[model samples]
Target: MLEFKVNSQSQSVDVDPTTPLLWVLRDNLGLTGTKFGCGMAQCGACTVHMDGMPMRSCSLPVSVVAGKQITTIEGLQSKTAQAVQKAWVDLDVVQCGYCQSGQIMSAVALLESKPKPSDEDIDQAMGGNICRCATYVRIRAAIHAAAAQLSA
Candidate 1:
């Protein structure tokens, strides 16, 4: 049994300790907002915040996260996150909407860590996230716009 706090709630899950945190969050906890793009961790679709760090949940084992704070898209409720969410909505950054959750999570993490990221940093940090709709350009723009809103 691995125990952890998810979205500020204590959770005790009985499963293979090696099971990826993504499965625990999705199948066990019913937090479907986190996505699974590439199970190999090449894609950032399953991105989530583990101890305030952006991680590829698909490859992260539940055991590794025991006794840590895990934040999913549904748990995000910060001024910066709000700004990013608003920018995402205002800019129409979602197409298929499948990767939006991960995109937004990654964006929030980036903006939180680096209040003002340069275009290259944004691209580098957000590069792993894939948008089938090809919304990379808009995603980058939204990140900048969100940063502006946050700094204002």
Candidate 2:
């Protein structure tokens, strides 16, 4: 049995220690918001916050997350996350919307760390996430807007 905290709740799960967190979240915990883009860590679709830092859940082992705070899109309900979501919607940042959750989560993490991120910072932080529809322009704008909103 492995113990972990998710979305402020403590949970105990019995499963393979090496199993990816994505499957445990979706299959066991029924938190399906975290998606699976690439089985490898190449794609950021499975990004989640482990102890408040962006992490690729697809490559993170369940054992690694044990006793740690794991937050998925479902848990992003703070003022910061709300501001980011509002800004994303205001700017219409999503195209296909497949990767928006991860994108938003990543942006929230970024803004939390760097209140005013430059283009280079945004690029460096968000480089791992891929949007097939190529909504990068809107994403950057939304992040800036979200920062402004958070500042207010």
Candidate 3:
């Protein structure tokens, strides 16, 4: 049995050590908010927070995160996360909604690290996350709005 903390809850699952954390989260833990985009980690749809850092869950092994903190979209309750979510909604940033969770996760991480990120910083931080709807402009705007809200 492998033990780990997920969304502030202690969990134990019996699975292969090499099993991707995406499956472990979606299938085993029923946290489907962390999507499966490119299984090779090219897409950021499977983004999640490991010890407060955004990571691609699709390519990560479950065993590697043992005893570590894993926070999914459903459990993202930080002030930064709230600000990001509010900005995303207030700015109408969702297209198909398939990739919003990952996008929000990445945005929250970026804001937490850099509360006042410039356009270049946002571009650099969000480079790995692909939004098929091409809502890059809206996303950037939301990030800025969220930062502003946090600053206030």
Best by TM-score: 3
Q: Candidate 1 on 34-56: residue-level lDDT in tens?
A: 99898998878899999998999
Name every residue pair that clashes in candidate 3: none
Query: What is the lDDT of every predicted structure here?
Result: 0.94, 0.93, 0.96
Candidate 3 lDDT score relative to the true structure: 0.96
Q: Which segments of candidate 1 are over 4 A away from where they belong?
A: none
lDDT of 3 by residue, 1-152 (tens): 99999999999999999999999999999999999998998879999999999999999999999999999999999999999999999999998998888999999999999999999999999999999999999999999999999999
Per-residue lDDT of 20-126 in model 2, one digit per residue for the tens? Answer: 99999999999999999988988789999999999999999999998899999999988889999999889988889999888988999999999999999999999
Error of 1 at 15 (Å): 0.6
Per-residue error for 38 in candidate 3, Å, reads 1.0
The clash numbers for all candidates, in the given order, read 0, 0, 0
Rank candidates by lDDT, best first.
Answer: 3, 1, 2
In TM-score terms, candidate 2 sits at 0.98
Question: What does the lDDT come to for candidate 1?
Answer: 0.94
